[model samples]
Target: MIELITATQLDYFDNLYIEMKGDAVERDDYIVAETKRGFEMLRVVKSNYRVPKDNIVEPDGRFVRLATDEDVKAFDKNDGMARESLSFCKEAVVEEKLDMQLVNAKYTLDRKKLIFNFTADERVDFRNLVRILANRFKTRIELRQIGVRDEAKYLGGIGPCGRAHCCSTFLGDFVPVSIQMAKNQDLSLSPTKISGACGRLMCCLNYEDEYYEDAREQMPDVGQTIDTPDGRAVVIGMNILDLVVKVKYKDDYIREYHCDELNAVGEV
Candidate 1:
């Protein structure tokens, strides 16, 4: 049977699923897994469950083993060192006068590589910064320039939705969000209302867009002249969810009618 395990780190947002052939593991158990960055300790977020091999794509990483006491110690040490490295890197950025905002840093579980994630408005020449970090840490250095969305993912916070940001909680990857999505849903064009903590269009805008788009196909646009049961009226507003349209007649009286009760005449 294929045993599926879900695991995550405190500092990172993405969950990693590991597949293995072994006894079931309990939630909160620490385990070693081979990831793209090498073997790292991850805490089990969900209990292991049996799944069909064909039901899932290849797992994110292979299970190495249950974490040993030594592994936990090493994980703790690495966490501390990674924080110190971030502090040092921030100082180096100031000293070098680099126009970049360092978000966080981490070391490979084996201490073979020190990785730094940063954000910048424009291209930043960080060759000297990398040299300085490599010399101080005495490890291979990787400086990654990430977008504003990624920065929010790394430093998580509650979104405007009054809950944790989706990208920092369960979203595996970001979907392309655009202003068109806001318009599709008939949402306010105000930036603050439609934008997320990252100052980009909220990811949730993409969730119900397909439904709105389909509904729009069956409805008349605002300002359109349509033949209502009463008479020809100018569409003034709409409640897309209920398929309701508000319109004004030649008498200047507005009335709500189901979209099904109206036929499109032409533009007002």
Candidate 2:
């Protein structure tokens, strides 16, 4: 009996499945005699823009070669994973009908559970969708909906920045960011200038919001009249990052001063 599948095993099976199915290489197991080669972990997606150039799963966990018709029966008795996979496929049919795509799907070693990964433009009403899958599959079914940011991370991509996208490369989860953070940082209000490829405000904004707020506390608001060494002037703008304020004085002369110096000169 093929005890466990290795990387070579996954690779061989993947190649065979790809060749056999052409444009539709759904994941499959390969039967092979164990060797020194490693196995890779694998996940199923509706489709991938870039297919793996090599093997999938690592050889660390319990694995085996392709199951023959007779082997399948024996597997059903001993392996819960095989049993669950069949149910997952059935559930996928209905889920596919509802969404047209599934992102990441996986099953447990024991055929006790199935997980579906997906993305949508807005909230999805899968009440009927879930019931149909549950009754037909006869096992646990879970559907996880993710955002485009999460999708980009799941599939992986080069971000608008020089490095890989944060969501994909390293950010396991997203932090909240807001437009006010941009205003605090004195960033251009234009969406494109501050937003990430995800079309949301950059996650970096959250990082500096506290500092911006602290700085704003030290500085006074614009349009407030305040005294300067030269003369009194109306505050026109604030430099949040530098903690400086621009004061408009006589003859249209404008100068920025430190916040602490505002009180030293005179009252507003």
Candidate 3:
């Protein structure tokens, strides 16, 4: 099992895991560590999570030690520097007239690497910008282009649900959320209704999908012919939560029946 922590306090910071090396590290402990990208100083938000035995740690970055008062001071200083660097990068983007929206900036604990995140509708050539930043900051520069969903995840805000976004608060990574998940749950097909603040399909759509899938298998599809206790009927609608079906009889009489009360004779 490997332990890890988030590298920055930035609300825009995604899950940048820095693996904890020793047992001394605990939750909320500020520590210095090396990440795949570069050396980082991160606070341990989580600790002692199990990893599957079959899975090997990729590009293992080691935990150096818990942070001291001096270390905290240095971290704060680097944070201020990160903000300055972000401002610097934004100005450089304008000077170069690049088509990109800068998101956030981060600096390695050793101050040797500066990572910049941005989002663009299409591929952007920031090669000249990187050179300018490298020369200005006197460090390694990384320009990362992220998707819209990722941008929303990085910079979280109150969702339409009037709560914090799941991506920034709890989700470790994005799971595939398709339009079918919405259909399976009998949700409104309206994009605005189903799409999240990210302008992508809502992550919440996946939440009840498993139950809906199981319920769907048990319940007859709309317009399907079925033999009910009342009579042979055509399914008109469903109450997935109640495991019940609404059917229309040949006489045009409509009634609701429990799924178990009906036999799926055939499709109409």
Candidate 4:
């Protein structure tokens, strides 16, 4: 049977979906998969489940088999080596005086490639550094430049909400988040309030943005004049979720009324 296996590599934490023709696998089980990068050892986050072929386009890769004891030992050894390589790369960066922050290093399952992920503000010249790393590791070297958001995903942290970072947790992909989303939700425009630990607009802001956009269309904006049962009132505030608007009448007495109970007259 074709089952969906959600797995991730220790080197790269992003969850990947793989289709396997197998009975079933439990969560946290180690499995081998053939990916574009080559054979990779992946830890299952979600167990195998039957998925209709018509539902999903295709999985990221095809699963090979469950990892044997020898495979696990090799994976552990590779992880240790990658960590050591990262430390050495960091020292090399310091010595070279390169303006880049090394985030992680990893070796492919076959030890054919050593990949390094780093973050830099501007264009970096790392030809000399690459040569140094190639000589030290005695393998194919790959230097990847990543953004701050991807770096945060690599190095997980607790966000301002006191929870683990979404990117580091279950977020398989990063969606586009904009300042307009914050505005649509009537949130304060403060960067500190809206930005995530990665210093980018919070991904959660996109979660309820569609709902708020629909609510805004149904509700009148603040400072708009609307005809209420009491009289013509100026909208002072709004509860978008509840479709409730607070309005002030000619006498300056404010009252709350549902959007359905009011008629839009015009802007105040």
Candidate topping TM-score: 4
For residues 76-185, could you state the per-residue lDDT of candidate 1 as single tens digits?
Answer: 89889999999999999999999999998877678888888899999999999889988999999999899999888888899887999887776656889889988988
RMSD, one per candidate, in order: 4.9, 13.9, 4.5, 4.4
Candidate closer to the true structure by TM-score (higher is better), 1 or 4: 4
lDDT of each: 0.78, 0.58, 0.77, 0.79
When summed lDDT is taken over every stretch of 10 residues in candidate 2, the lowest stretch is 1-10
Candidate 1 error regions (>4 Å): 1-21, 25-30, 43-60, 68-70, 260-268
- The collision pairs in model 3 are none
TM per candidate comes to 0.80, 0.52, 0.83, 0.84
Cα error, residue 125 of model 3, in Å, equals 2.2
Model with the higher lDDT, candidate 2 or 3: 3
lDDT by residue (1-268, candidate 3, tens digit) is: 3344453232112123333232455666776666676766666556556655585445346556667788778778988999999998899899999999998888777888889889998999888998899889898999999888888887888888899998877676688999999999888999999999889999988889999999899887898887887668899998888898998988999999877666443332
- Judged by TM-score relative to the true structure, which candidate is superior, 1 or 3? 3
Top lDDT model: 4
Candidate 2 structure quality by residue, lDDT tens digits, 1-268 = 1112221111223234333434342434433222222222322222233345483544233324333565445434534554455456546657556653456554433445556667776666776766766686676777778676665665665655677766654353478888888888778999889877767787777877999889887777888887877788899998788778999987899998987787676564
Q: Which residue segments of model 4 deviate by more than 4 Å?
A: 1-23, 46-58, 263-268
Model 3 alpha-carbon drift over 4 Å, by segment: 7-22, 54-60, 250-253, 263-268
Tens-place lDDT per residue, model 4, 1-268, is 2222222132222133332243356777777777666677777666634555585544556567878898888888999999999999999999999999999988878898898999999999999999999999999999999999988888889998899988887786689999999999899999999998889999999999999999899888889887888788899999998989999988989999887766443333
Worst 10 residues of 3 by lDDT: 7-16
Off by over 4 Å in 2: 1-97, 105-114, 122-142, 266-268
- Which pairs, if any, clash in model 1? none
